[model samples]
Target: MNLKVSKEAAEWYKNEMDLKQGDYIQYYVQLYGGIPTVHPNYSLGVSIGKAENIAIKDVVEGITFYFNSDDAWFLEEFDMEVVFEKEELEFIFHKK
Candidate 1:
């Protein structure tokens, strides 16, 4: 997929996300609406879909990049309480 990441996300992907070359970075890209799962509930949170992970190849966008299952599942079940803007950040590194 063609993930569109913000400058902040790009920096995270390059640094924080710890992405290598082929890891899987799960993300719930915002296409429709509602605040991201990570962000706290907002009067203007986007009403998109449930959070999911995207392999490095599929992750085209999102802010919260998960490194392990705990992070991924926590994000997947994140309550709308944190108000952090969402953007794409590649985190998953696929194994060859």
Candidate 2:
């Protein structure tokens, strides 16, 4: 699995989330309310926190974006790319 964050997306997050260089962005599986490509009735969630067991990650603009080991089931079979589009951030999943 791979985690990729586009430069535009990283800038968007930095500005929108009011984050600094050392901040951590975590991507996790949430119950609902997003356009999820991997699982039905599920979606991705973003938060700022330190990782305990990072399975995959990408650093952009000095911010660390990652997925925890416990969320492997959601990402193990796909490459995730976060991009900025239409003035918002989008999550795209490419099946491995």
By lDDT, the best candidate is 2
Q: State residue 92's C-alpha deviation in candidate 2, in Å.
A: 1.0
Best by TM-score: 2
Q: Each prediction's TM-score against the native?
A: 0.26, 0.91
In candidate 1, what are the lDDT values of residues 5-28, reduced to their tens digit?
344554555465454544444433
In candidate 2, the residue pairs with backbone N, CA or C atoms under 3 Å apart (3 or more residues apart, or in different chains) clash, namely none
Q: Candidate 2 — which residues are off by over 4 angstroms?
A: none
Q: Write the per-residue lDDT of candidate 2 for residues 1-96, one digit (tens) a residue.
A: 889999999999999999999889988888987557678888887899694788788999999999888886788788999999998778888998
